[model samples]
Target: MQYLVLAVLVGCVALLLAVLALRFGWRLRWLLGWLKGNVLLALLAAAVMLGLAAWDLQNFTEIEPRAATVGTLSFNKVGNQQYEAVLTGPQGNETVRIAGDLWELEVEVLRWHGLPGALGLVDGYRLHRLLGRYLALEQQHDSSANGRELLPNLHSTPPWRDLWAWIDNIEAHRLLEADAFEVRFIPLTDGAQFSLELGPTGLTPVPLNPAATAAMKRFN
Candidate 1:
């Protein structure tokens, strides 16, 4: 991942250098000669970057952040006022899924990737809409616009929403922690079949979006 990110950065710099070289059409020859003076250093940098890129590519292929599949989730009514959800792991998995109660349920993701969606996956915003109930994703950040932090959902910035969005995003991640209603995207095996908290602090669960789960309970 780091190599992927660095390659992207260097690629941009390389592109700019190419543009500038074109702009100095007459000095191109002299610039080429000057570049030769640093050929060894330039070659070393290139080798290092290429090596990093290769390592990053290898890791990307081997690592999967979250196995979105290979697991099943179900919620059931233990009684009239009480609900019980069971999260079980597959043959070779550790993560589990258990929704104690939707009212106190919370789902949060760091919201990386505004990666253009392919396959069945939708872009960040559309995914937000479709899974709104189960997930509560805050708008992404934009540093290039208006010299202020703002919501990534919109193209333009409104100071008020921007400020709220920034503050809320920070608070959301900080306030939620372990023992705050067992978090498992897939199945978690061993230790704490469930996490129980007696205090009010660990009481709330921030489903990535609350709207997506309205139908979850209906499944039972």
Candidate 2:
């Protein structure tokens, strides 16, 4: 809290000083000296900060807590700490999502096409929502409980598989936070260049690009 306050205070002071310098035209000498002396260092510092921020964001994207599921996919420890898929579906809804590595899952292509049945192909996944960026998925290893080793598993299957592929190939904005962020939709890659909010559950899609809504249909 103190650090946040300090940052805010520093920004305000900088702004105030800048305004004063411009208004008075007297701080010109000091400003020039400061710029000449510190400009490169300031830029370097900014670059470092941005780099650290990016690294932190990457870490956040790589890992997520357990007990969380993406859509209907629940992650569980199948065997030997490997991941397993658990499909939970009711009558109308038929869906399959990968477990364990939710945040690691990336969005391939988020088509505005509403899921054909109970499953609607969304622009992003629960994993993408949590991380704030999508793509570069790492397949999870699956091992049988009885000491049998199993091969790696796909992140998602069925209707979501194709969309996941799309997000992988595109770059997009990750919502800062669901409840507080405002999303603008740009459907260049169907969902490649856009920002989206997953809302509270992270499953309830919010602010879907309305322009593409025409392509969307309810499950039939």
Candidate 3:
């Protein structure tokens, strides 16, 4: 949409300049030639800029989760100290592995707000980060869980990757904190109907309701 407006603006300005040059006669002949060349160069530059902008929009914008499910989490002890949580939702099942005694689960809700969101510009959530406890509170094993794993690679070849990182950097400052875990949209086939919220005391399981399961069918 921005690109469309820019192109229209540039075209109108170029047309106006062309009309002025033709009306001014031989005195502006050299200026007309220069303007033509410069306009072509400007158009090429604008094309590149528009392409980059489109890519950035596609990669950096966040849309509402297409499918949000609320599920019940069941924990089962496995091995000596390790544990496995089976998240059974209406759509499907997901397994979350917890390696430490002290662990935290972070669920983030990202939305495109203001003018950008109104324009229907959207982005998406990472499925693993939304449901999996990939990071531990402390480093205990050789394969330490780094929060950086959740972030997209800055060195990635995609031109839009930097834009994505920049947008995330902005959102990082506005993270939401909750006392009673607020509702979050889980992107899964058979996900939980309600939102997942984490606090200092850890997650408290919510019993599955047949009514909620029926309502969550709308997301599917």
lDDT of 3 at 188: 25
Off-target runs (Cα >4 Å) in candidate 2 are 1-31, 60-220
Better model by lDDT: candidate 1 vs candidate 3: 3
Cα shift from native, residue 199, model 1 (Å) = 41
lDDT of 2 at 42: 90
Give the alpha carbon lDDT tens digit for every residue of 59-110 in model 2: 1221122323223322334443234433332212222322222222232222
Candidate 1, 97: how far from true, in Å? 13
lDDT scores of the candidates, listed in order = 0.32, 0.34, 0.44
lDDT of 3 at 57: 43
User: By the TM-score metric, which is better: model 2 or model 3?
Assistant: 3
TM-scores for candidates 1 onward, in order = 0.21, 0.21, 0.34
Q: How accurate is candidate 2 locally (lDDT)?
A: 0.34
lDDT of 2 at 2: 100
